[model samples]
Target: MIEFALPDVGEGLTEAEVVAWHVVVGDVVEVNDVLVEIETAKSVVELPSPAAGTIATVHVDEGTTVDVGSALVTIDDGAGAGDVETEDEEPLVLVGRAPAAAEPRRVRLGASRPSDPPGPGPVIGHRTDAGPRVRTKPPVRLLAKRLGVDLHTVTPSSGDVVSRQDVEAAAALTSEPPVSAVADARETRTPIKGVRKATAAAMTRSAFTAPHVTEWLTVDVTRTMELVHRLRADRAWRDVRLTPLVFVARAFLLAVRRFPEINARWDDEAQEIVVPHFVNLGIATATPRGLLVPNIKDSHLLDLAGLAHAIDALVQSARAGTTPPAEMARGTITITNIGALGVDAGTPILNPGEAAILAFGAVRDMPWVVDGQIIIRKVTQLAMSFDHRLVDGELGSRVLTEVGRLLSDPGETFLHV
Candidate 1:
């Protein structure tokens, strides 16, 4: 019998709330077949199976938040009723078929596991006195239990040893979560597990640890506002959602190129400054569940239109809770559009692992100095917070100044290629 344990989805996610199960016991499944859908900190991911066989048992009920290495399902490879090594002491084997049953349980969202507390737990799998006995690779281990695959009975075809394919093969033999489990309750709470929990802890640590320095500058972005209006009226941006945020993103991207040091991270471990050449632009979005900063992988490579589309897609996905785990990782820079909430400006917190964050304030018609004369112009404030460890006052000021310049005179500054 193969035992499938939940894998780390991404961003160090330890456990996830089983939003759904696509496979059940007695069902024939193939490798790469989606076994379950789990909700992590930032998104809902469909976990694929690892092995091909008959699902003997499902340890977790739908909506239950299982720990990372907790048994999700058992797969029987029809290897005959002989001596088999199973995680459980019962030592079950691949016998004939059996009738399926349902188990109901409640799960909490954003909650921690009992065994793995805030501090420490098993890194990959549980360790016993006998020895280390995890069946899958790091990635495969993450995929196994997530897809509800049993690893013990899974045959590793790869000459190199256990791979994600083996775990996926084991998952193909299962059916969806039981219908009775779905009807058990309309609402459930899953404690934050895995990446979600880790993100929370990191954010909390950063918030309290960093003595944040926020500086705000209100600029008369009449020209930028005019460009947005023109773009909206143009046929090129007809389908796209033309908003100030798009221009803000573009401006920040360009400004980062001018002041590259701001687009870096402080590595306290190595006592070094890590600067990135490319930009993974993160947009802070408020979802129904919580705050998520899903980013464009390579924002530097995208044009204004591409950036707008990417931002739109990311925001929509985040709000719907469908953003992928991969999209939320490796962000070098971040932006929070606080203006959407009608706020003028805010001292936004920096995302962990990144050195700086830009807060785009609300764009509104306000009296401003234009050519030394007071005039009603489209005005907005830009607030920036940077890590003092990597970004000194001069670099932060230069980056913020460049962004202000671009916004104030977008026509003069060329769009970042």
Candidate 2:
């Protein structure tokens, strides 16, 4: 019997919630056969079988969060199952939260060490006789990265090169993933004018194409608001503008470290989900031209003070109507502040290609329960919408919950800040 443990599907993902199982005991499987769909912090990934085997026993129940390297299944591969080496190292992640140094590992697809000789052509920088033979675009590379598939193993159906269809076919094992955005010219079209033409057309295409799922959570942030007030009086923050949004961004960044998948993109053309190591956090600003979401490049690398300064610069440039065109594009995830407009919360449409968008509602004085005492605490609502195709309910809920948790008790996030 081969003992299979859960692998870190996303960078720094220590555990995953088992979303669904495609197999049970007594079933024979082949290499790369999908065994189960697991929701990691960043996205829902289908774990493939490493060795063909007969039914044994599944160790964990559905919806249970299994830690990295814990045995998930015991498969009977018969007598022919060779001496497979078990991984003994911890998950090494370049981005997001750094994995614990002593965490053990298990058998997984594309398992290899940095010192190990690289796999063949089909992956990023796979070399051919001339140099590298993989003829796929960035989207295909992104898809392969997310699926954890080796490009060298994928055989393209058409042409003398690997294509998106080939990668999707190899990974999804189902029908092709739908193209992300599609715009149609219709008679009921709104005129090609200002924001309606610029924003509506693009957003309509995103809404119709991407499968969006939004989750809401109400959080008590009285302490968080108080912290902001305290920071404003500090000499370190004297030059920087400290606002609730800055704290919200900090909390969101802290959550991203735990749930990195929220900072991902759906490369529809590449036909796969893309998880970025760095966070290009988009701040949604209402402007005279239209609703513009200019993002902070490498926001994850910045500290709390740096984030506040970045937010100030981004908002200023946006409101001045001098925000560059490049800044408006390439947002991985977004944060929309509805409280500024006197709204609590609203379902937000995702910026095109981004996997998720988070909405921060108005924080106000509300009656709250604190240690069995009735008190007025600063409360707020957080609404999050993510692509259902990439993110499931479990993943979405955990990310939103983490954000709310940090806000409700931000003292825990000081270590990260």
Candidate 3:
């Protein structure tokens, strides 16, 4: 019999909630066949079988959370079905035989200590004879270190084990100093455990780790808006919702083709640069749960209508909180539509691992030079933030300029090249 242990799905995920099961006992499964769908802290991931076998038992049921090393399924190899032995019979060893047993090894504690040991110094109640010290666990230690709190100063009142609440209390005390103020306002605190927590850590890591450089440019998107208006009236786009975001996505793809370096990542461990040939276009979306950047696979290969369909599907999945984990991984580039939130323009941060991110601002009627005279035109601002280590100033400028050019002259794009 062979037992299938849950594989490590992604980076440092210890456990996952079994959202669904596709196979049951006595079911024959092939290698690479999806057996179950699990939800980790990052996203929903599908677990596939490793080998072809007949499943003997299902260890976990739907909606149950399982650890990483736990047995998920048992498969029967049908090799030793009739083998049986009595209790008096000795078990056979794979090797010839075991050697004679030897005495066990043991170490004596405090055997080499001096008579008069060093004092505990200024630490109070730190007894040397108190069997072992009661402190936080490994995870709690990491949390305290991240929060910049000295664990020695924390008062442990919750018995020997420190709970998450204790760590949170330590964090709160260390984050803010003593301040005296009159209570005149009511404030509510929301726990950051789910998507909000993950997003905050990612943004903080990206901001501090990468040297961010942002460039802003105002563009006349009159032609792009006109194209959107015309497409909305067409019969093909009748059922489809055409917005400025669609045009922005297409332009970003075109820019990526022109500037390939912008769609690359710096692999610090391997001492190599990874430039993806295909574009997994990530659309930064604001959902009811939190901010998510679920992406569309091979978005650069999709045409105008295909891109529209892909964007619509991704947006709907994100809003429903059913976006798959595989779709969110290996994103080559990203675009955030700050324009949808009625913002003119703002600097955006690069998605972790990606070299660049483009921010599309709100399009509004603004004065522009037309035939050497100022006229009201549909204008929008484009902000591009890139990692200086991977993308230089000239490459960033070229990518942003290409996106702006495509938007300014949508019809000319087809005629020029």
Order of quality (lDDT): 1, 3, 2
Best by TM-score: 1
Q: Candidates' TM-scores? A: 0.72, 0.54, 0.63
Candidate 3 lDDT by residue in tens digits, 195-270: 6667888899999988999999999999999999988898977887678998889888988888888999999999
Pairs clashing within candidate 2 = 26-55, 42-261, 121-152, 122-151, 128-131, 128-132
In candidate 3, the residue pairs with backbone N, CA or C atoms under 3 Å apart (3 or more residues apart, or in different chains) clash, namely none
lDDT of 1 by residue, 112-228 (tens): 433223575333212222432334433344456556565555677866466766766667777643222232347534445544575688788888766577788888899999888
**Candidate 1 deviant stretches above 4 angstroms:** 81-199, 412-416
Model 3 alpha-carbon miss at residue 26, Å: 17
Worst 10 residues of 1 by lDDT: 101-110
Q: Give per-residue CA lDDT, model 2, range 1-417, as digits (tens).
A: 567788755434577666556665545566556666665433345566655655455777654768889877766565434554343354322224332222123333334433223565333211223334356543355456445456767887998677767877787763333232233654232223333345676689889988889889999998898888888898977997888898888888878889888777778788877898888899988864467678998888888888989999998776654454445556678899998887899999988788888999999889988899999889999999998887889989999999898898888464255
- Give each model's whole-structure lDDT: 0.72, 0.70, 0.71
Residue 30's lDDT in candidate 2: 60
Q: Give the top-scoring candidate (lDDT).
A: 1
List, in order, the clash count of every candidate structure.
Answer: 54, 6, 0
Let me know the TM-score candidate 2 reaches against the reference structure.
Answer: 0.54
List all candidate RMSDs to the true structure: 14.7, 19.3, 16.5
